[model samples]
Target: MPKHVWITRGLAAIAVGGLLAATACKPGDGTSGAGGELDGVTLTVAAKWTGTEQKNFEEVLDGFEKDTGATVNYEATGEDTGAYLGPKIEAGEPPDIAALPQPGLVREYAEQGALKPLQGEAATALESNYTGYWRDLGSVDGEAYGVLLKAAHKSIIWYRPSAFDAAGVTPPETWDELVDTTSRTLSNAGITPFAMCGASGWTLTDWFENAYLSHAGPENYDKLADHEIPWTDDTVVQTLTTLSEVWGEDDMMKGGQKGAVQTAFPTCVSEVYGQEEAAMVFEGDFVGSSAAEAGATVGEDAVAFPFPAVGDKAPVVVGGDIAVAMTERKGVQELMAYLASPQAQSTWAGLGGYLSANSGVQPDAYADEFTQDLSATIVEAGENVRYDLSDQVPSRFGATEGRGMWSILQDLLRGSTDPEGAAKALEKAASEA
Candidate 1:
């Protein structure tokens, strides 16, 4: 059986907390420590994957190594990384290449001269193949530093088809309607309308950013990128207000407020598809697989839809993927070139469940309808594609100061802080950072 998943609020907090811990370390240029001769032969790669993830990466790297006659060394720490690769890098033993989920962190390293600029064919491939928002994730100050490898769809709401059918509940089309539906589910059906795992700082942060995008418009996130906007903006206040009301309702979320605090991450996912009575969950597309891995029949039993529109704006999604680069070995350049190629992208999608970043590169292996539809949604997103705000924000500010926004929400839920007070608290954090 698959691992019992806990998508708890605590896990989310720990994940972000791990990244935040990396902020205080002294920087390194990934130079080989101990004055060892720099070999242009082996590429020590550190990725955020282990077990099946490690196996999949090894397959791709093995192909690259075999085709190019290069030595490839791979290590995966998975999600248990505390300070990530920061201390190892600081000790002068940094992996020649590392694939990280946070592009904002990658950009910080690049700014400190830790990352080499990816140019020529690699840059061109990224520009032409990936969506513009994805390209922006790995970019800092107008220069492209990282390659786009995977695209995770975030604007998804996973629900049980059986439950909706039985309860005669329809997926709402607008934010107001969604809120109204939540109330209906509680008052009429006695089911928890929304399942919020707020104890996890990161997951709660998702609510903050998602609601922020709709209430404030996606461009406000871009403004935060440039330090043009404060965390205390009125838009943020509105989002917190909305979440506070919805999440505050008794029996609004399964397990109640206390359960929201204690439940794990995977549990939040399970609340949606674990049973027909659990109802819907607002999370990323990956939640679908989590439900399936937890024993729910995917596609038929569970279905996903975009977060309903909050106002006049179209639905906006948040997500990006990990990008990998091996050492600068002979023909490693060629392999890197190929890694960014459409063929590589197609193959990678076949090996893993993530959406391919290479434009027009659809895989032959059949994926779930939701996955396929999500892929099409990425392609058809036009110019409205926005990445996860917390992922894109600088670690010092984003990881540290920005993540505290979750606690502010909790305070709002408990009626300890009003919208205006919460906004000011966020502004103080942002300004201090």
Candidate 2:
């Protein structure tokens, strides 16, 4: 996922009334003390958030502290959490709880016996607040080890509404229509149709994953993610060929293949907003914030539609954080339970820059109508949502640096590798990994 910039204006303040009505108890509803009821309980929580993100999170943590009378020490663990926490776990001094960003990493830690299973109130809270899809994402084998804290809808196309109106084009409903629409936008409107963020290899992988999920369906997607089906399988070949229809075209992309392969993710959104070099960019909802940062008005100048269907139905690919526990202390369990509740999720949602999969949370909890609509779309998808396939796989085969999908797909974007060749290379990489 790209680095996110939150829109803080017009956010609703924390609604203690709503929180009280939604949950069984406020942290220290009846208890009274200097530290409240949970006095002297200090939890060490870690995550990959820093700066603005960390500050925003602390606001929510502060609410928890006031309600429960417990203190939380938050540590910004950076992106490579495995490396950061491995030594701590080895030394038997892991944080009480950690907000892991990757479901794959959570599963890895669970299998290594480095995590505690959610039980009693925490388990019940998760089961009540989240959907089956979200709960399943946090589970490894048959037990729940983590709980999802935030979610991103990845199957979306962010476009300039004015550009679409100028081109006299409505968002396409099918893959064939999308191709035709792109051609018409280029020819009639005289604007580049799509901004391909090839410089950021993850964006390219997202393109392939969405197409593959729509065409091959969810079962095949799962098989591919688990490597039960090799990347050289026909499904992968078909997906790459489908992607190449647009990606291979010389004029369909902003700067052609060369320019696209050099354009970074932020630049891709800016091209659609600031430069007006392209009409649309395919990415997650996070692009809306990026567009806003570049001086484009979200929900007006920039808007999005669900990615057009490639087969029978459009698939929603999701990226999110999964909160996992490192210890089994009672306070740690309480904190995990709180984080899984609608109250905790709603507080963060009201602060902007956050989206929760907690079904119990009201749509209006979001900062703006646009974000509320995005939340509704995710709810509409329901069980149809799929975790990002690349992120679900091992990093060696899925991540950017070195010989992963990033390098392989960049070659495809440069027209240096055909669909078949790319499939073969992907299979080889997976096998080696």
Q: What TM-score against the true fold does each predicted structure earn?
A: 0.83, 0.91
Cα lDDT tens digits, model 1, 45-68, are 777776765677677776655545
Instruction: State the lDDT of candidate 2 residue by residue for 190-306, as single tens digits.
Output: 878988899899998899888998999989998999999999999899999999998898788888999999988988999999888888899998897799988898777887777
C-alpha RMSD values across all candidates: 9.7, 5.4
In model 1, what are the clashing residue pairs, if there are any?
6-265, 6-266, 7-264, 7-265, 7-266, 8-264, 8-265, 9-200
lDDT of 2 at 9: 20
True-vs-predicted CA distance for residue 51, candidate 1, Å: 2.3
Error of 2 at 281 (Å): 0.9
Give stretches of model 1 more than 4 Å off. Answer: 1-41, 78-82, 182-187, 275-277, 324-332, 363-366, 400-403
